[model samples]
Target: MYNNKFYVVQDGEFVNPNTNHLFSNGLDPKDFIVNQDGERYNFVGFIFNSEKILISFPKHSFSSTDLEKLPQNSVMLNKYIRILFNCIKRTVNNRNDKYVGIRNELNSDYPFIDFLEVYKYYKRYGLFTNEKEIKKFGYAGRISWKDTMNKSPKIINNHNLLFLPLIIKENIEQHVFISKCMAYVIDSTLERFSLFLEGEKTNLHTRDIDFSNTSLVITQLKKVKRTLFKNIHQHLVDSLISFFEQEKTKGGNYQLKIYSFHLIWESMIKEYLRTKFYGLNDRLEIEWSDSARNNHFEKKVAYPDMRGMNGFSIEPDYYLILNNKRYIFDAKYYQKLTKLDYKQVAYYFLLKHFETNRDVNGNIINELETYNALILPTEYEIYSEVHFELNPEYNVNESKFVIMAYYLNTLKVMEHYTNAN
Candidate 1:
């Protein structure tokens, strides 16, 4: 119960304990999950249950800077896991308003941690204010007749009543108890995030708040008496109820749930472009937006109504406006840009086909001048912009194939993503 497990594996590497099904809940976990290109991919995330395991599945590349290594818990391990977790949450919550709830599909479009959205909303718009009777002094409800003679004070006007000791009908102790209960849940989560930190750890949080028990947090929940008002309170009540119910049925003991870490890798790359690369004009200002942004980008390329090609659309990970030129960057999680990636080439042509402006006399903006690259993660530990031209021998003036592959250091991206957000 005390062991803070840690693990650090590349996208497709094999591990010792075989974490395909570490916990009995969720899906029957599998090692070597068939990933991009039908190859097995390792998924990683910090387990938020009783065991406190910190698993990290960085994509394609990671550094040996004494960090990463998700299976064994350590200060370094906690940090990498946190960075990945935060990245996923930010990436999801940025587009979603937290109230949108979790999306369910055969394959999740993005990483989703269970109840993270609800936790976000409840924490933001806390418990509802109670309806109560207010009194002038110490919440003494309803002025009494005996007080008129006993005190013999001037109580002629409403002003006099206002000056008396203020009191409330609802029990103050009950509210304080409830607030503490919610705080216990939040604070404990923060503390557990650092449970495995060794000598290299800092004070994540004291978690000083205490509550009677989890049941009180549930039982003490105030019920709304009216319909047409299933606001945040109602949503939270149902969510928390479902949470505890699933905790028992799923048998995860409220462990930290996570989707594939590649989702994080995609986010990390996007964050790097947004945060680290200064003066980098984000062509897509709504870049952090979730699937909707993907749709938005596709909308820009209006389909030609059953023309030569239809149906599928191009949604580049990033179509940045950097250094006064358009660049299409695809953040691929694979270790290397496999042999033939027609997708990037299609992305280039799709935009050119639809480019009304930013083009030369109805042509695709001088295809040679238009830039495109596959931004992949690398194990290199420094800030690098290593670019590899897909067709190195091709002449840009004639072939106009400005295709390239760029290797960005994973540690660099992680550090920047952690700090920028």
Candidate 2:
């Protein structure tokens, strides 16, 4: 907890949909305790003030009713005394060393190198190195450099609970710069970067983005995007391994080895929204059945990566619902989509099209809405590798075959809709 505020991670039942009230009784997420030997573990703490009882989990709740009872930093161990502002500020400021190590691991011309270039770009473009004479920021010298980063904006005056570190302006601006860079990674070379958004379709439906989700993904993407992005670079290097291919590389081919997964996934989702879902781009309108009797509006369908006790799962890398027709797709990262990949896609088709169903109270429903499977390849395939199994049990091969062409093809389709408007 920083400044008597706590970092709360809410996890439990008793979620109120109407009130948006998460259980008020749960513990804060970041509370930790130190052992006799100075080892730290989970120690939840909360501070109370007035009517608000900042209740944290396990132990430690503070009440402003007893303002004098709060623990001070002097009593707390240094390791356990993490002020959220100081920690994240330290992380961002000292990221150069971590990035240097990352760059050392990859070869030249790697798309990730370009990705890292964004950090440098932001520092330059955002004028982050230069200090401004702001009230909350350390430019006035009242607060420490680390504390300055956690400075909250003046307008968002909700200081009841612990606010995010740094001023809202700096935090958002910095994150937006990073988010734009991530978008560039998708737009530039590879047309995709592996990104895990918080929820499927929620942000898409709204005109504005949820900055919190973007912030979370940016931090996580730095860890995983490095490996996946390098795969694209490695493929380009290996593809030119043939002797004849070497002759065309005299001027040096720009090896854009960016994992196609990110771009392809982005394209598939965006296209599905534009072409199929139309204006309803925000929420995932999926129909699922996981009950004794299949029904459309029955049992609560699991979201996104839905897994069940029976080992039956619905993993839709890109889920498309047009009118009432369902198109389930799983993206494959490959230099070429082979017959084996087709079989894999065919399997998913069977899982989505045939086996998966909706359940009503005690019966099945929605036999009219057709479900189709799509094996969305990362890039263009020279020849159609699609094939159907002769199995009568799951007629997967009967579904239409679509190569998905390129990322632009989807964009083009979307543009057509926009232009028509």
Candidate 3:
């Protein structure tokens, strides 16, 4: 522990500590130990006061109560710490395949602890409460003779009589439903924590996570069963893979893991908007780009171009379609929007209006209305909405560009969206 502030150490270096209540002035780059790469990690939004350290990670701001729930050496402390360490390790090793762009944005010095906070936000706000289809294997269910033949004879013979084997099949669970996946993650985390509390050593080379847990309420999860007919909870499964999978570095010497906070923030906003506006109008539709290829555009030039390229592809964050109008929104975690940011979104607007002017139908569209906005996070109570009119030379009709800042507090977001006119 540094100055009586308890910190978990992995290989003599502080991994993830409770910096919310730490003494900010005491937090110096030189004070913390370096990683395996021989570099000191940078703690983003870390303020060292004389008495305590105020740490502001993504999705964790303006809320002291949430911080209080996670105190130093708490029962559930190891899970959070393990999460932080794994996330950083994953990003550093380039094991994060889902959010490649966001992973590229991560630096070696970025704090792992802050990444944990962003994951918490995803768990609370982004994940849905629906069931998904997963493959399951068990002897309690019945199946066709052909299906039973696919399973191992030993398992079938051991669980059932030879004559009745054809009537029953071994249940093979393979799909991931929302509730079951949640339970699996919770139970799996608790089991790992139990190992730490019981002084059991994991196969992991590092001894960063070793602690006791208070109790985990998993009674409801135990009742969930895998079903083949259920729909796949794609969002929940995508989010849970980071926590469930055991990803290792290229050298296979250590484990690497993390949930993408960039994706989490975008998902939270998308879900919030959907929930808030779903019942507003029957014709309203919200669409996500999902990938660059989905929203890509090709601009063909007749003459020679600067890069000698025929076209370029552009992808926006999200699209809100209300009747014949389209609103583009880009969620930014930065404190302020820059000129380049504005230009990028404006370019997206130009593409959607001019190049991709067709609707869901194949009918040609002559004119289109488009609006673009940049959503930024702030710590203060200032409610500022700024708009910039596009140049008239573009010849676009009813084009609007806006930069809106909102408080980083999740509660504020809910309140504003739920009560907005």
Candidate 4:
């Protein structure tokens, strides 16, 4: 294959680099596969029977120059590109401690074009670190075919035929930090502007008092305002720094263990909205709820498997109310769906709809009409063409529910559902 595309699915699943499957059962290839669309591209077979392999492509095939232009509906491809950019950006910025392994894996001929595209994107962002930094770690520019025996930045923990996601965690964390910094700048700037105006208003109010009264009042007001703004700005900066510091030590564990990962995911969600949907952040509202406080309804409510409170409460990953429509989206870490997964999302929709009632202080007050939806990650871009309709009963309840499952690339379609449900 000169410039064809391929996908690497480990243990029949497509997930992050540090996922457990890459090293599960003590690093075995029996659980892994490289597929061309639905067809299998056996990496183990290539290793054992090198002569029999005739479909290998050069690593450079992944470059943007080699591959044809991506289709307009290339949802999955976008996600892969994001992942590659983040990983390489992590490595390039010196935020991540591992890069060589990810580079090696991407350089492999398995999914030559995808990997190359990822590398090209990474290079575009100035993420691929320089040789000076690489040599400082004494790597000798060689790829190690061993597990994480060394903590050296250049050393990659290789398994039977692949590297663990944790090894590349440094890269992930770096991008996450940059994301948090951007958020801090935005949030802090808004806060500072608000506080500054409040101070000005206070000063103007004090100026109207008697000469003596005004003098003292103005002085005190100035002190208070100065202190207040200083403290608030410092607090915002501290909060941002503290978040990244905590994420830094989160390590390779997923979910709560490496909890800062959510920051990155949420940031991605926000960035996606800004760039693609003309800044929908102002219109979108997302939150989580728990039933432990007996907020209402007969049944107990708690989201079993989501980002933070894993089984702690029925907090939906995203309970979005956009364009007056209610949507409930749950991010599934698992690639493929089992029967239970479907039922779980279905229950979420039912309960969410059930919760929106007159007895629970529902928001339907006088004029409340909206739709609900439950979406799964994109099975196909065409699936988006199918519009959803809301029942009249939900309008009476003044509550809507929707389940949308989506990958990063497909996030555009999901975000576009402001008027979808």
Candidate 5:
């Protein structure tokens, strides 16, 4: 099993239970497997039936020459990742108190590359390290007879209690810790990149980073007191540390998987919208569901089998409240939305309308106009918006809810929304 998930190599391609089902359904494997160019591929990474597969896209999967042939949507994945990284950075910068133990699993075939981009941005400013006072027994510095007596008593007797100076130097504890972190990231990236290029005969030249030197520095830096590093260096160190901590907790190869990407995409959209809408209007409030329980709303059960049971609960991705109206939004990172996806949002809209406050004279008062929307990442050259209105003529009530599709690229959709608002 790879990362505790079973997979088999079939026809030189990795097939997990999920992807296997895709193949069984007669869909092309290439449609689901995305490469760096955003092109669909039949295979990615090394084709091996190993239990511990490398967590990265293979370097040989795409070439610079194939850029023009790539699908238009191929760039959307990278754009989304970039936006997600920026959103997280913004969160770290502003409201740092809320950043404690914040973890998001990255789901992308080229997660390391995405992370490398973020790492490079921070590295450009240089790694954060602090000056630490370190004392060491050396032949030439301040003398310490106590330390000398503790060690080499015979030498002291022969030299009339003479002792070497205690060496003192400013140590970069934070830098060393950061170097150690970077070394791990670099080594893992190289290992996964190697897996992707495993049988190719071409002499591919991979970009090199001095991970060894960083690691050596880490070893030397360990001699100093660790607590000396202050929170001043947290901006750079915390960002990278949180990423590594996330990967380690997930217990998978270094690559970001698609399942995790769904969460990341949802978070990116919420954060992006939050930032964009900030200070624009006081009436607009963006709220997130911290957990399923917190977001849950009870609905009366009528089925015989479910008798005596509590009401069912529904949790939408987010609620965009403008004045008294609530706009329900569900973020789906899939290439296409399914019927169940539509029904789920519809249920939430209906539930909200039904459970809302009623007028004192036995009428529904202030029937908050509701709209349900499916937010999706689109690869279109131009943005598109589609609305499916529920006709009241066919239905029995004046209450209406329009389920709309918001096709947007996170990297460029802000301008469209801003102008419309």
Candidate 6:
């Protein structure tokens, strides 16, 4: 947090819902923390309301809230935001085969808003018992036979806890409260993003639902838990709860724990390479091998047990062969590759020892290049790669990197991460 504010564009910063919420201050990234060692976070268009940290759907689509500092120009900011969006998407897609998702709408007609604003547009503002109409029953409630006898005036007066006229509509009370809470948030959302009249929110449902009560909305949403029906799915209820919690601060602080983002980064890098070399197998033909020459991209090398039945499948981050040369890629999310790292070496020797995959010469696959790289999401014009020399004296067997350590340009790959196959 910087200046006691998170580095994320607040909902209030957005002027309109169109243009995908870009070209507005609201989409500006802020309070971005990558690794465990949290540092100062300060950036324009990023001060927000969430006290802790969370992500919010400001522009209809969801994306990670973390971003590295870049040029202050709108053009740069907009591109970076797009990159972050694609990065998270790639990350999600990598973890799961497909995207099974759920989220509430950001703008336009809200579900609750349509019910009050457009659906009831024709109904004039009048007193009705629908909800929030505090109707009072003037006459007394039920009277028992003993009350008419007036045997004891005190006993008759204090019959049933002294009150029967008070009718607590428990069901409607929750709905009304929820609707009011939703309306308050919707109006606040419109106030920040849309150009509407002061009281022109909709056909005035009633003064009971405060049109401009952000404080009340936040307090109720964050503090007051509504008693929903038992029939409602817990997931749906949880989603609603999350929605309300997120709305507590329209300009919510999105925090990304970027430490464990290696898996996602690896996925992004793999996808990018796959796109670049789409028809790779057609160009390379070998006598014996698994589907690496066909359609299987992320193939694992499994060495059977003593029984040669089933053993753990040892797999590299990515493996592919082109032009009679094998390529092994490890998409690492670190500052730099270290000498201590030996996974790439293991992959190199494993491929060399594996008998199934070999060149036409009949020797172990000789053409092998491993790239262990750190991914940086910045505006680096060109990507450069350098080979890391290993010292042989350290260990007896581990010599020079059979699995070569290479520095890859990550920003360049992300450019095509979300591109078509």
TM-scores for all predictions: 0.62, 0.28, 0.38, 0.29, 0.43, 0.44
TM-score of 4: 0.29
Cα lDDT tens digits for candidate 1, 1-421:
3464444545465443555455434223453465555645355444444453435456644544443433444555556655665555555555544213323320132112334534465456653344444323344555544443444344547454432333323333223333343444444444444443211212223245323344644555543223316566566555544443333322324433344455566667766665544422233221322222221111123353455355655567776543345667777777555566787777776665454344445544433235666767777733323243345465443354556666777766766676763
Clashes of each: 20, 36, 23, 26, 4, 5
Error of 3 at 101 (Å): 8.6
If the candidates were sorted by their TM-score against the true structure, best first, what order would they fall in? 1, 6, 5, 3, 4, 2
Q: lDDT tens digits, residues 1-421, model 6?
A: 2223113332212322442233233233432323454322222112123442222222212123322232234355456445644555445433364322201111111222222332132234321122333333233443443433343233336365243333322224234444444344445544542211123343324467553454565465444344443432223334334444444333543222222344445666566555444431221211222222233346456453353436545666666555445556665554334454566656666664453456688866554433332222222333333334456777656564433333344445555665545
Write candidate 2's Cα lDDT for 1-421 as tens digits. 1333322321111222321233223322232323344422232222333222232221111122222332333343222223311222222233445334323322223333343343333334432221234344223224444544355443345655443443312322233232433333323322221111011111212224333354453454454344434554333223212111221221212221111123323333333333333221212222222221311221112323344455554444554444555544444322223354453354344444343346765344653243323333221221122233234445664444332322222223322323321
Across residues 1-421, which tens digit of lDDT does each residue of candidate 5 receive?
2132322221112334554452343333442565444433232222222333322221122233332233233354233323334443343333334343232222232344334543564446443345566656666555555655565334366558543444333344544555545445555554544422212121222234343454444343443324435543444444454344334323232332222334445555565454443211222222323221222221233222233246544456666555565556677765455454665445554556554568777677776666566777654532334446666787666445456666555435433222221
Return the TM-score for candidate 3, rounded to 2 decimals. Answer: 0.38
2 or 6: which has the higher lDDT? Answer: 6
In model 3, the runs with Cα more than 4 Å from the true position are 1-56, 63-97, 100-260, 278-310, 338-340, 355-366, 379-384, 390-408, 411-421
Per-candidate local distance difference test: 0.48, 0.31, 0.39, 0.31, 0.42, 0.39
- Of candidate 5, the 10-residue stretch with the lowest lDDT total is 197-206
Best by TM-score: 1
Query: What TM-score would you give candidate 1 relative to the actual structure?
Result: 0.62
lDDT of 4 by residue, 232-265 (tens): 3334334333332322211221110111222233
The C-alpha stretches of model 2 lying farther than 4 A from their native spots are 1-256, 259-314, 332-361, 375-386, 389-421
Question: Per-prediction RMSD in angstroms?
Answer: 8.6, 29.2, 15.2, 26.9, 12.7, 14.7
Model 3: residue 298 alpha-carbon error in angstroms = 19
Lowest-sum lDDT 10-residue window in model 4: 195-204
